[model samples]
Target chain A: MSTAMGNPTAGASPGASPGASLAGDPYAPQQDTVAGPVFTVTGQDWDAVVAGAAEAEDERVVVNMGPQHPSTHGVLRLILELDGETVTEARCGIGYLHTGIEKNMEFRTWTQGTTFCTRMDYLAPFSYEAAYSQAVERLLDIEGDIPQRAQDMRVLLLELNRISSHLVAIATGGMEIGALTVMTIGFRERELVLDLFELITGLRMNHAFIRPGGVAQDMPPGALEQIREFIKLMKKRLPEYAAFCNANPIFKGRLVGVGHLDLAGCLALGTTGPALRSTGYPWDLRRTQPYWGYDTYDFDVVTWDSCDAYGRFRIRLEEMWQSLRIVEQCADRLGNSEGDPVIVADKKIAWPAQLAVGSDGMGNSLDHIRHIMGESMEALIHHFKLVTEGFRVPPGQAYAAVESPRGELACHAVSDGGTKPFRAHFRDPSFVNLQATSILSEGGMVADVIVAIASIDPVMGGVDR
Target chain B: MTDPDARTDDDKLRAGSRGEAAGTAKQEPKVGSTPQGAERDLGVQEEMPENTVVPAGADSLEVIAVREGMFGVQGSGDTSGYGGLRRPVVMPGASPRPYGGWFDEVADRLADGLGADAQAAVEKVVVHRGEMTIHLRREHLVTTAQHLRDDTGLRFEVCSSVSGVHYPEDTGRELHAAYHLLSMTHNRRIRLEVSVPDSDPHIPSVVAVYPTADWHEREAFDFFGIVFDGHPSLTRILMPDDWPGHPQRKDYPLGGIPVEYKGATIPPPDTRRTYG
Candidate 1:
């Protein structure tokens, strides 16, 4: 890790002074020194010297704000230069969470990349998988109208993930501001969401459940019932959240007007999700660039024009409700399309022809195998070839963008007609969104920096990846 | 075969006149015929119609010739020859448009401003597989992109993505850069592709146009070794600064990492390992 030490003072070098006036000094030799004794005794000279000394004393102080700070949210560091308590300038220092997942994905097969990419943005694992899978599918040119059931399942899982992610954001943001109960409630609720995920995907954190062709498995029985119950429970719990945090006078005092970013600033800096919507852009990808049957769904693009910290908080809260609406619609869609194929028919991109024993200790029915192997030679051949060699993508490039919990998650993939991607770059929202923290924190009190950083809600994994 | 000189004369005639341009060119009529390239087990290329319209004029003729040659070498599969699935539906710019709603109107305005020579240079307007890729003469790429940004129907104010591709075996330019632009108000996307010779992969920088393009172009250059003229800062991003050769090129070897996870040794990239 290399460190960059920026210059801290004027007149620290030979070229420190501005160019001499051309009208007066074109032919004259430039002065290399002050051209006077160390102490000239005129009254104005004495005042000027005193003022310069005082100014030098008050120049600026550099404070490293992270790599392990409480308010940083993750392992982010902001090197801030302050004039007293007000921040003069702030430079964001990141990459503390560098996992080399993008490079690692090059070594893995196309399908295995999902397992690694999904973990980049832990809060929005589905969004990461969706973006990566979409890019690979574009390379293979295999967008075979993913089944309606699969689309609905994706929407359901994505929305649940969104709610779970926002709970963490709000919880951590509150904890940073000394609201202990919010953290407790937020984690408690998030645990329930993770429990739901564990039941459905069989893993808590890196659920490689969402793959290229489709989901890894069909929703486990009673998973929908649990989700429905969770939704009902959340409808009641949301008000408690509001009463505990949103409506609290102290919380409002800390958040409402601090870290204001208007629409123009948000757009200029490329902020999105709650940060952009709070500034009144209302540019949700689901509403604008609809993918995964989002065009068929009905939900409001939530927005708040206040462009303040409180506005961001308000937008996320409302977004949870909108997500709930999406979840309910997805549940209805899934109920109608039960027992359908979760994976697409293209065995080249789908999972291998094998089954795992269920919790009930029984493998999938023997008929499934006979139908795959004995019934369809093409399917069998594709399975054998794909499992052995993996899919070969044509030499091309694809950029797939999805609405992640934080903001737009775009994956730009390039292939050289090979089994592995040549280059896979993730335009993570957290990385870009963190840029606004400097703009928001400038001239604000040092204490407000914590509030501003929290409002941005950057996950270092997403930032550094 | 017909007289070659007569075909050139007919091509000149087609270039001179707009109404007779599509018909007068005496080249083989298999305009969009699929190429018969070496076959791989993976069915990647999609087949195209033999007599698809090829745009008239010198630049368009060159692009069509290149596209045809690509297809000739690589046999077009069952789908459209323009890569990927056959004719993916394009989401047209809708009225009362959702997100960046003003893109279509802006793109049109830009095209009109570029006038006929530049517009004629555009070879194919493809909206296959849901991606909008505009094929244009390599010479007119920067100019067309400028027009797209400045024109009315296509105010692609944001160059959201810029990437490179390598095709070592191809006869024409083996390296290409695909630029994705977004009209924030219009909510439309247009992809601009520029191909340069692999021997000296170079293209004009769009950094002066879109600031966000700086890092993306650098990354492309870093991985693919594609050079951008007049870029502010061109340097390696994800790889070590002193690394040799472009890692993303087709001929470059994929390096491996040796690791044992749960008592299983992960083999390197060169070693054969079943994906499943």
Candidate 2:
């Protein structure tokens, strides 16, 4: 490696003048004859010089990992410089899934932006909506008076989103490493969760149900029953999922010691969620920086100290069970608040009457309209104004962060004192968590890179949005 | 489990006179953004055509009508008459950076430990909104990045995100790339923004300092037409190489051909269309 040092420009200090080295070299003794009495170089000194020479060697080979390859989880390309299979350097390339959602939000109304944001992190749409809505509501300063029932409903929905997101992580992580059976079981459980969401919001994915002021509407009748059934179903399957994947020798071999990231690397790479938690850091936003009534919830923050891929797997599996516990508690709370209004009574922020198509192809009954219009002029005018024009938000900026299944999902919203936000930026967990990939992939087999990425479990929509 | 009754209601609504009348009438405007004071003064009845005459205390309803793009009014109005509009305020110091000299203070603090290479590399520091971004010279980019990570007071440590933006029409700096850096101990974030001329849009790569920047720099190179000098593999991640201009630029016309959705012809942005 030191052969390159023969060039007069070699090992020169960044700021040193070119003339200074030449002046010093010619004046010095030919072989340092005055320093030692013709002493031969020792084996230790030779080894030290050789090691120093090797440090300056530029022998690493560059390899492109993917833009279309599997194990990337998405359209992620990694440029790795390697000495054999060991990576000397790594670079991650992303933005294949960029859809300009932030710029798109600038053109949309405050309420309409929720619909676009929900599609950002596909696996955890509700969590995305919740963070966006919470920011908008905070800017409006009307979130304080939000109905208790609406708050409870949001908690219930977010917890379910957490479980569904983790299921994807577990299933996909297992599948990426050749554990095909875990994928089937994971999807089967996730389908039940999606079914519950479909019953409430009329869509399985991208359910823009949670809005700025409250949910899109009250839970459909028997939605809680479906949720209860889902909880029971997930509870019974949890053990089977663990037994089929977690306890299997093949699964353990592939995951247990692969992609180990120490706590310092995790922090330096800005990793959060399970990636950070698995590294012995107890930094869950739900516990440390509570939002969306998370402070009121009673649950334990699950953590692991192994800081390896298996630790992440264990943490997520345990987190799913904890989410189920929260869901059951939320269902109990919902039963008590059945008759209470789900949205805040403020007409500016909420729809006048919950509009649903009836048997007669009309939004509301004639009698209902008659009672509202003829009997109460204020109600009639309020309904008309709200239906025609939405509420205006005060111009200011507010940020709201939620403990998403991936990590801290935050929305930074700026209103130009208008009905629409001037700018909306999402601090997506996937974007932050994906930073750890290069660090985890280095010094590991190329196959382990797949497991490391799966453990991170980034939703490309969220990462690229 | 499908309901036949639901289908009959949908058919009736489709066939009803109410639907025909509603379709023929002027379509309702998109909600939000009417001056609140003027809207409240117009009162509730003013929305109806029969009650077009101004009501009592309606002097504040000054309607300045727009003629192009989307037609709308922009003036003071009441909440009810104009759908909860609020007056727009010209906030003081609402430029890109609102925090004034604070960015310079932060940048000066960085000058000491970053060494002369980093100091020479950093050209301008601007504070936009609450975010501070230090613009750097392309040649000294790697040195600056290393200082940001290793320096004690400015231990950015992590490169949280990197993205690119295009301003093709803008002179001097047409290709803008931004790097978001975070210090976990400080729990603070700083942005490193660089701009290169469109003619030769190449900046030094930070991949050596933070490996995560490799993908981000390549993406910038791909979408915004910028290039990273030392990037290992810089190629298009989303669009094909034969693709014309950077799509994200504000001036780049969003056009490709019409997309037919549910029998509705949705023309490209550049197409001329007459909406019924």
Candidate 3:
């Protein structure tokens, strides 16, 4: 390939920074008077350049960390300008995993939207599904008609998802800082939650269980008992994290006062979740702007006063405890909502098939098949029409937000009175909070950049979507 | 930028005033008898007979397009026998006064905040589905945002999201950017929308007011090509830097590349037959 075509920096440069190229590109490469050679700072492969340039006597070296770095989290690439060990500037290169999920949703039916959104934030799939479903329900003018049993089930799933997501955040944060035991134990406890999820929704991740009007179906037999047992197990396993790392001097020395951002900084950068809560402000969407019956839940919005990475870590740990409390309450509620319908009563909006596990694995129940195929021709037509064309939403727009483990995951849905959405946009917290990378890591040590980004815990799936 | 196939599909989905006789086959009597182009002028005067959920008053409704089939099909593939489904794709038009609840209070405060330029700044206030949207001209977007952030009565602290929508039919204003602002102090939310023509898609950047708008604005510009003129870094955030065109625009195809199956080439999604 020609140098112009092989070079990724030949086109537009980032911001107002002059592009760095050896040829006629507007961002021409600057001469390195004392170094090996001057290279453009766009490509992900920079180890060879770094090695050759480091041999020089220069103190200022620009390092291109990975779009594939194991420590920088998912596909995030960090370009750090280091004066020896101190980072003077930091820039994030994202969009390595853009799948155009939002654009794809415009062509599919509204019910099919949940399947796509659930895959956006892979760690917190339930949060995205719930937010999208709530938006669709609001646009359909049937928000009040969602059954109580469905609402309770959503609460149950959301709380469990919160626990699992926070576990991964803490686990990955620990592993990035060389604490492998936390990673091992975190996934161990997370597996129990996943087991319960598998029992309930039939998928460990990307469970499209939440639908537009309600959940896909009611819970199976012994699902509640399994949840009760999981909650009991988590209650015992919860304090092990604090006992392991809370008082560990090495962990505190590595994380304390690293990646510090105050309340004003958090608000300015639109950072929410534990990162914002660590600044001693109790700003949670569930408490301030309640949705999906979260207002009725008995839980506290945990906060830490350090305004640093350690505080954010502590906040996540405490928040997991609070999530466990909410899960307990949801289990009690789900137990009382026995035999209640989980989907809406509106036949037009509700999914017709009552799903059952058959010889073919999972398909429409035999009873529903008999009614639609044998008993009533109208039932067959209704099922076919609803399945193919889906329900229509009135022409308008609604914004629904849910507090995901990361932050506020909001879905903005606009319908032009069609079976599919006219425009749908998700305000992914990972995408927004990631803008704080420079602010958090600029004046900090180069090694602390990992701690800073890990504290934010941005999942690149949500960021790129 | 002006792909003919995309425009045809757009017109088929929302058959604006052009009203080409694409799917005018086997007209059912109950659907409509009004001719294609004349429906735009005549239908604007009376409440649509069907679709009761649409608020009454022809003045409030903006008839984006007049449809003539159950499914938005251009040729003879619509065999559902419901070809005569001629309903105008009507958006909830500008809402009237009283606005209700906190919406009126926000409008009054924003007007006070905008001062002398309030009349020129705000084109209209639309309250739909309990959400308030203040449609503003692109020129006054930054000033209005600053006031909304600083004004004590209207303290929308966090600009949670910035999204772009492309309306190819809305002739002078094909590109729209909506800013969803949340006020943590008052615990309320409001949206501000600005529209610009496709010829000159420029809107003043609100990054100075809301620092969080930096990335969101970049994403919007990458997708819709709406330029936030004063942005610090007006580069592509999602798409590749060398990408040919904005992929999220209505004129851009969904772009499903054909897959090669076992000894056969499967058609792309856009080329395949589709149901409603």
Candidate 4:
């Protein structure tokens, strides 16, 4: 940390407005081109822009692309200073969909925190759910108590979510660059993945089925067969995605040399996942620091040396194939472990809901009710106690990080020996990785900004959450 | 425990491989500024011993523990369903030496790297569960973090995350900033924590050392109002620019409006009855 080095705003000045990078003035001198003029309204950066303009003078305008454009990839706003068509500088403005998820977690119980986390990175909700659940499980000091079947299911679901999420990245990244054909094909594959999710967890999205003690329940009958079918279907579709984008000149040209962020920039900006892997560093948390039995899974950590949008796009394409291999292994494990409890052995932390879908809907199993009401008073009391006042977590904090589709999606759970979370701060990879857009997009053509951001694949729900 | 042991064996083998790879990586043409800890600390403390082995374990000391109430309220909320639950949450005292696997190795490395100021810089070393946390004085955060990064034996190059936790009950220093650092080279992880009193909530930012901390510091400022002394731009990130208060502070309300449905009203959970 540098000290206040004479410049009032350089180091630590309390009043330094962070948004000033994109804080252009609404009433600055304007130069008209397409998308309006570069308004020097931010007032301070004007002189610097003006001074730099003398060296490479043209009509250098500041273009505010989006807090709400279709192609900006979720409500990300880019403030780009264009010298003719080439962008001289860029800055990002985020937090359009701030729901205060971190603050809201304090009001909910430990088991309920999974529901909130899963919603952050919506594309790969299961991984976020796993990270939060794993943290709570660790906080209870019962990471070991979770069953082998439960851990296997977590890996299976997470890898499935990764394929679906990467499909979205390819689909959306293609759509951003006018490759609409690939988008249709990508989402078609995503539909198959989401179908498997619905079959396994009973929800297509935001599945809180991954519980603190273990998963909410065991896999539905023949759910493994559905995954096996999806894997076979996906293995066929994988080459189609590669063939569509890998050969198209328009797609390759927009990505190959454009929006280039070197390996050093990736680290400085905290870029990981595919974007980091594209820089030729196979630093996947699953391989470098394994969690949730990922170490046991067999898969090659895919990497690329190009370090551009093309490299990033290729990595996601290759990663899907790798995810399928992992899923295939999970299906094999599930076959041998039939009727194993998905929930932990301890009755305390595990949610004891019977979860039977009847005429009314999913609710307490009628058999569980009969057993409690007609058979045992102790069973009823235990059910009532666990549900009403959730289990207590020993006072402490633990940070859990998992490799999601975006990057290292992590959560810091603090418990003050209470049933509810004291405070849970999610270190969302989207929020951190979104910072790299400025470093990558600047000094490149204005059109490539979209190419860069789409490759990063940030979900504003995660960023703003 | 069984899983980690097997992973540990795997990690040692991987560490040996990574070490050989790094030796070759150093010879590659300079791409840009290297973020590796050892490379950055090149000449800072060259005189120190290459590596120092932590001696025998110091006998653990006993400190008086207190169960003080937060805001002077003993069991503030109503206690009904959870009344029987008793968990005396104690802030752990300083851990004794020979602190289990890899922890003592890290502490010894930090001591050798920092030299004479090691004792003063490191406020307390707590090894809880299987993880170790090095608590540092607020002013020494950056220097200590640099040492944690640069030391050859303890190269926690990647800072996994930085989170702010407000413990209203912990008097004097109630707000704590925790950093989770990862040593990909050695396949190990450790936590670093720096606490600042609510009266003066300031800790020097480590953005220069770990550029990834840039947005995270802004986020901590937005939610918890922790003033990072050397942060480049300390402004609101997640919150609206004009948002009034730090929302994550324990004193702040959960602020959810009651939901009105068809002929029914359910108050937000915070306003509902709760056990103390």
| lDDT at position A151, candidate 4 | 90
lDDT of 1 at A93: 68
Worst 10 residues of 3 chain B by lDDT: B22-31
- Error (Å) of candidate 1 at residue A323 is 0.9
TM-score (chain A only) for the predictions, listed in order: 0.84, 0.82, 0.90, 0.88
Q: Which residue pairs come into collision in candidate 4?
A: A24-A42, A25-A41, A25-A42, A38-A62, B37-B150
Candidate models: Cα lDDT each:
0.67, 0.66, 0.81, 0.75
Q: Tell me the spans in candidate 1 whose CA falls farther than 4 Å from its real position.
A: A1-56, A138-144, A346-349, A352-354, A358-382, A392-396, A415-419, B1-108, B115-127, B135-147, B164-176, B195-208, B214-218, B221-254, B257-266, B273-276
**Residue-by-residue lDDT tens digits, candidate 3, A215-306:** 99898999988888888888899899999899999999999999989999988989999988999889899899988788999999999999
lDDT (10s digit) by residue, model 2, range A1-465: 011111122233311332233334443211212211111222233443333234433434355556666667877877766565576666677777888777666555688889899989999999899989988887677778788889889989899988888988898888888888888888988898888888877789988899888888787889888888888878788998788877789888888878788877775555778888998888787777666577787888999998889999999999999888888988998999987887777777786666565787654756658868789898887876554344556544455768899987878675544455655767788887776777778888767778878888888899888
| lDDT tens readout by residue for model 4, A323-415 | 999999999999999988888878877766547778886656888889889999998889877876677776566788899998988888876
Question: Residues B2-42, candidate 4, lDDT per residue (tens digit)?
Answer: 23443343333223222122012221110011111121122
Question: Among these predicted structures, which one has the highest TM-score?
Answer: 3
Q: Which CAPRI quality tier does the interface of model 4 achieve?
A: incorrect
* Maximum-DockQ candidate: 3
Model 2 stretches with alpha carbons more than 4 Å out: A1-71, A77-93, A357-391, B1-276
TM-score per candidate: 0.73, 0.65, 0.88, 0.83
- Locate the minimum summed-lDDT window of 10 residues in model 4 chain A: A1-10
- Could you tell me the lDDT of residue A128 within candidate 1? 94
In the order shown, the candidates' DockQ scores are: 0.14, 0.10, 0.49, 0.22
